[model samples]
Target chain A: MSPIATAALAKTAPPAPPRRRARSGPPTRRLMAPATLFLLAWMIVPLAMTLYYSVRHYNLMMPELRNFVGATNYKLLLTDPTFWHSLVNTLVLVMACLAITVALGLGLALLFNRTFPGRGVARTLAISPFFVMPVVTGLIWKNMLFHPVYGLLAWLARELGLAPFDWLAQQPMLSIVIMIAWEWTPFALLILLTGLQSLPEDQIEAARLDGAGRWQEFRHIVVPHLGQVLYVVVMLESIFFLTSFAEIYATTSGGPGTATTNLPYYIYQNAFFQYDIGLSSAAAVGAVVLANVFSFFLIRFVAGNLNAGSAR
Target chain B: MAIVELKNVVKNYGGRKAQGPNAVDDFNLTTRDGEFVVLVGPSGCGKTTTMRMIAGLEDLSAGSIRIGGRDVSDVAPRDRDIAMVFQSYALYPHMTVFGNMAFALRLKKLPQAEIEKRVREAARMLDIEHLLERKPRALSGGQRQRVALGRAIVRQPQVFLMDEPLSNLDAKLRVETRAQIIKLHRSLGVTTFYVTHDQVEAMTMGQRIVVMLDGNVQQIATPHELYAQPVNTFVAGFIGTPSMNFLPATVGDDARSLQGEGYRFRAGDARAAGLAGKAGATVLVGVRPEHLKWCGSGDAQAANHLAGKVDVVEPLGSTTMVQVDVGGQRITAQLDSAIAVEMGQPIALTCAADVLHLFDAQTGQALGLPAQA
Candidate 1:
């Protein structure tokens, strides 16, 4: 069977291994013991500490008055207006970048699919943005391009006889979205292009023989063939985008008036600036819950695709 | 319905460097309307290139092609009104049988009713009506083969090109589907340009076979003509089952006798007259396995007999193959199973002079073939 079919088939199958067979061999648990113990300590310790802090009135500024809070910190973080604003910002940033990168990534991948004089060099250059460090990418966009006084965009605007527009001040969320897309579109392009290249060449010949023109071939064959990779790109990007922090920190610093503060940056402000450790830990736990909810939908969506793949 | 005319069609890779190798060099063929023409050759013999040129998939380096009396040299594949069945089938994996067969008609902007009518008719003809709702991945290999054939049939194109379409099937299915294809060809009566390297398919399926080797056509003739009177040693060695055996011999001054290392045979005047000009030169005597007969050992020294010891016997119930070792060379001969020839037994073989083929040894060109009628 093909690897795709095997993976898809494995999804529909029950998780439990045959008990008789597993018991017939040396215990499989013995091999898993060391890794399992290490992971337990690694993940469970931080989680237990966070849970401990979330339920108490712990404040580094006034440690003498710390006591059992009993959901007080949860109520405080949930009722705060800044928390709601940051939540919206996170969702908007992730959705905008997701839509832009996937659409443009597919277009760029199709562009690179054709043969050219410098195709190899061009492809290497295209993917170079994805490997840049987040801090460097953030600084480069903020200082060299989005800077209103002497940035590249300002120089170009001056040449066009237009007023120099302030990017970060006027549209902070849009600037962050563009920077993230620039760094991530290459990832989408790499995968979608591989999918396009892997399609059998003969099918295109057959389509031509059947009287299909270029547009019809791409619409009917190319689009549907890229379906799985598109889903995967969206899922993985969503998970990473939900926790976006470094780009916001390095560029906007949570902004002129909290215009670009996302969930992670919001939590950082509460903990270090306000010395509200209990509230920050509660917000961190909320972030984990939100990630779990997104994860549930993503796995269900992928399983649906896999199940349909096996049906074929 | 169409005649495909390829006039000196040439295909060169990276521009011909005065004498660089052509993938296809100066290929020419004209198929009569409704005729079945198959190009057969070993791999890299440019058979597939000739078919692709007819379909307008591969551009010609020079010369021109005319399909149905219209010059199609500069036309796109879709504009040429041709349909191709690829060796890989190339059926759309996501489409059902009806969808695949109906795709071409839809492309031409045909009415939905007419497209349905054509798709159903082709599916019925190919006995794939029940599979109309099934996608390619759900069908068996044989079903997929029929769907590919049905896809081409539904197009009703000016010409049909098949690039070894049946090669993916098992042996049993290959044989059964061949008969079905012949029936479809007659019922449809569309001109077809088929390509394959299998001689058996060439003999059974093609009205005329174009034997090619090394980007050049070796011979183009009917199956019987290719079998009985091959123009050269390559066709002789390539065409028949248990292919024709060749023995190196020098012609005698009288032009009627040949002497080899351990075999001697006589060629009568009717066959030898063609070789009279090369009387003193060396030549090859070719004989088909079925033409060699067993003779008693006492008569082994007769003018027409060659004596050797049997090296292996393969009995096939009704007939047996006997491989004989003569001097240091091996010759295979077919005999009736009742003859009961044993391995390691000495055998005498003889044949009538009419069955022998004489060829110029150095050139490998036939010496005694009657002129083409």
Candidate 2:
């Protein structure tokens, strides 16, 4: 209406528009700073150094000579017959050990799920092997159990009127696989048993009322319920199995040839025995990549199971 | 449909010192085909244990259970041809609603089309057809219970066993779902045995209500029968809201009159004949709160009368409950809401002689009613 009234209203309304206040601080920086710093110092630095050394011709034996090698170590390792043989041996051992441990672990988990007379004592004994140190486990199996003449195997064979055979020499890889499975099966059993115990009791009763026999119950209800936990056990066990060096060193020492030289043992041989830092770094980088690939698949499977379970 | 018979069944929890009461002692029931029977009791009354035994989920320590005239004491739960709805609505979390309902058929290796047909039919009956594709976690609690009911219905077993299935719902939903369940039972006309500690549910839902206390059946009768004529002191005290009031009295003069402190009641001809020759013996005079009325003035037609002062008055919208102190004992009276009775007012109440229940104080048994009457 009037110019003076308009001016007064505008003056009373406010001055120049107030600046919009910031809506708290950026949350990512606040939450992730410590983890970011840790990864930078511990993981990223070492990984970058390994990647650099993997392509460079830098040997501990010839420290003054450094040159860009451009994947020469990978080429050499891929072409080497010994490395190929060790790789094949490692794959076989890992798969066989995993299969045996999973089967035995599932059986034990089911057995212990029932109410028996001494179930508590039996469960405590079942989980004991997982607590033993890896080096001690390797030594116990090698020196006191599988030693050619003095160990339990040879002693038992002699008692049976059979010739005592050399275990490490005749079957180095198989013996190592057996030793690793013995040590790790308890881990799988512990996790899977917890899963089995945590299963909803009402579902089982409902299945029984639905006329499901014991076999059907196990196949349809129990196994599907255990899928997520089983994935966790397999992933954790695989990580430990991939880096299995203490056992190999204590028992076979990658011996009899390159028969038992898995990736970790191969890296150890290159760095400590052959004094070839470049080849060792390359192998270590390759092992890390392989482990990541395995873990990716495992995490995806576990995530899918969790999603399905929650959807229910 | 099949009738379920539990003959002299007993379950013992194995007492710690060999002297404790049995969990379920000499329990017996015979449920007719197409009838709805409810077992009602307080906690630790062994009602659920009895239901579990009938379902073959629990073993009977004594006696036998028969379904369809065939003994099933040694049968497994799967072979019992009975379906149960648990209080928790134990739907398989990993299975869709359709799968949950179809699981038994799937186990029987029924054709896929047949399984689907049965599942859809049950879902339609439950009005949960739209939820068939969803898992249990995706449904609300009432919907999940419907799914559980659907699962049981799909089986078409000889009997349906429900253990406090509506206890998990909110009060309003419980009432709504309760009516739905009763309607469902009537239409299906399958023999059903339901267990609940809620007396209201038992009274409203069952064709016959079995009242239990301390693992023993106190009374089994229709709702009207239980309320109008309870068998003993416990049943009289338990079956009604505010319960029947018991006052100690002495029977005298050929049991034609009962005398207590500050009160005397003349037994009518019918009750007098049934209770004669019990003079000087202690008995319990049971009167429902709703049956007592203010006498207003002395009258010869009043069979029983007691002088008292009102101590509390509670108006419950439709009715008023008045608690009065009479001769060192307090008694409650239910009155119509229109009465403007005030606290601390002196009043006299009278109870009709025929409505009074006489129980032997020592035996806790009704003095005159014959067994099975």
Candidate 3:
């Protein structure tokens, strides 16, 4: 039949069974020992702890007898009006921040793409915001810039003889959005600028020779080339905005009575301020799921466009 | 149809004086309506720069360019009504071949039917109708080049500028596409300005060839004129395949002869007028390899006969190129393949004095000759 069977039949019968080969190197236990130890201590242990805390009525105030309360924490989080308001707030802030940042970043990128006087300095200043620490950005915006009476806006208003208004108290969400946009616009600008720079110069020249006006070139060449970079910028900005806690904490402290209380801030409030570990873990998991959903949609859209463009 | 003219066009890159040579210096050319002119030189000789200036892609430092008798020096490239086929093909990567050809018309907001009609006609002319639906990236190199030409044809610009368009193709494809481009130019009857470094292309395609060197036009003439009578040593060496060989010579009272170690050849009365007052002066004698014949096969006692030893022999199917060490200097002679000449054999070669090119050794300027009839 088979070649292996023929080879076996040709071999003489041995008095003793053929010696089995032993593995020469370190055994399975030794090979996996370090990785298993690391996983147990770092990943699995924390995940198990989170799961244990998530399914029990656990709080710092009541730790004597932890009672199993399956789905209670999740139900409470889902039904909580404050939780829903925070989720809406987070969505609005993320959407507003992403839209404003992408628009401003693309505009700046286009502006910097041209050769003009001081272009080098202008580009360096435009990207400087990305290097600023988020907390510092928030502080600078909150105290030195957007502060009602003594900040830059107030000083300008006083000079103009207009009444100064409290920015944070009057519009907490808007204030936070403006601050976040300033910090993230440079990120978008860097990516979009690279995209613009990498675009084929000859194709643009060809379009010009083909009688394409400035607007037509933008629509057909520049915009299509920037599409992928725009997607990446939006996706990354959304993820950062969804999990934004330090900016809000350092600036508004989720003040003005839940006006700036996004999901991450709410989770922070439950875990550290209210000491409701189970509720906070549930909310954290929810945030992760929502981020994944948005990321999935963005990636799918980018992939579809890439495939369509490539196919053409 | 339109005539194109470049008047005193100068392009200078402002920087350190030692940065390099000027890209283009005070260039001028005029192409009559329906004329095919090819600009040819080594790379960095400013041929492409001159074409780009004509296309309005590069602003002239100081000059006026006119198309159809209208000054277009300051006009935008699109408004100049000139289409350029770039060396890279420069096809829009995102568009289909049909779209690439129709882009200019679409930009002009031409109606769909009119755009389609013009695009289809151009595609038919370039024989790329079957590839209209495919994107440029999917097409072969030659196909892509045809698409580029089709794009230009659809515009029907006054002048078509091509910058080494066939250089990217393989050897065989270049030949095939060269013929196609020449035919296309003839059929369109557009004033086409082509820039290339390949002399064969310049010779075969253009009605007139402009030979450029060091940012200056050396000579402008028909292919036959350029090959038969180059204005200077540069043009002579640059234009021909297996370029004309130059040997130092001395002009005497009655006869001019190149005297190397064991070789001396008489320059007869053909070049006597150009060398009248230059007796005993050192000069360069240029002879095309094909013009020289083995002595025994031809007349050995001819006036322009030089004896030498054959150092190398390269036999092509139809001809043999024998490198002869004449007076310690190597000179090439093209002979019939039937010649039974072997390496190291002493031989004698003769050239017609009328075919000999004599040049001043100091200036490297051609000393002899009226333009060939």
Q: lDDT winner among the candidates? A: 1
CA lDDT scores, all candidates in order: 0.89, 0.86, 0.86
In candidate 3, which residue pairs get closer than 3 Å at backbone N, Cα or C atoms, i.e. clash? B261-B327
Off by over 4 Å in 2: A1-40, A67-70, A298-312, B15-20, B262-274, B295-301
Error of 3 at B64 (Å): 1.4
What lDDT tens digits, residue by residue, belong to model 3 across residues A120-158?
998999899889998898888888988996699989999
| Residue A305 C-alpha lDDT in model 3 | 80
lDDT tens per residue, model 1, B1-373: 7988989988887644535788788888888999999999999999999888888888888889999899999999989999899998999877778888888898899999999999999999999999999889999998999999999999998888999988999999999999999899999999998999999999999998999998889999989989988999999999988989899887888878898877888886557876786777788999988888888777766777778899999998888999999877899999878898999988889988788988889889998677777
lDDT of 3 by residue, B32-75 (tens): 89999999999989999899888888877777899999999999
Chain A alone, TM-score per model: 0.84, 0.85, 0.83
Candidate 3 has an lDDT of 0.86
Q: Which stretches of candidate 3 lie over 4 Å from their true place?
A: A1-53, A65-67, A299-312, B15-21, B255-262, B265-270, B297-299, B371-373
Q: Fraction of reference contacts reproduced per prediction?
A: 0.74, 0.65, 0.63
Model 2: per-residue lDDT, tens digit, B32-68? 8889999999999999999999988888878899999
DockQ of 1: 0.42
Deviation in Å, model 2, residue B120 alpha carbon: 1.1
lDDT of 1 by residue, A1-312 (tens): 999999999999889877778566877899999999999899988898888999999889998978998899999988999999998998898889989999999999999999988999999999999999888999999999999987999999999999998899999999999999999999999989999998888888899889999998886667667777878898889888988888888999889689999899998999999999999999989888878887787678866775464333
Q: How well does chain B match by TM-score in each candidate?
A: 0.97, 0.94, 0.95
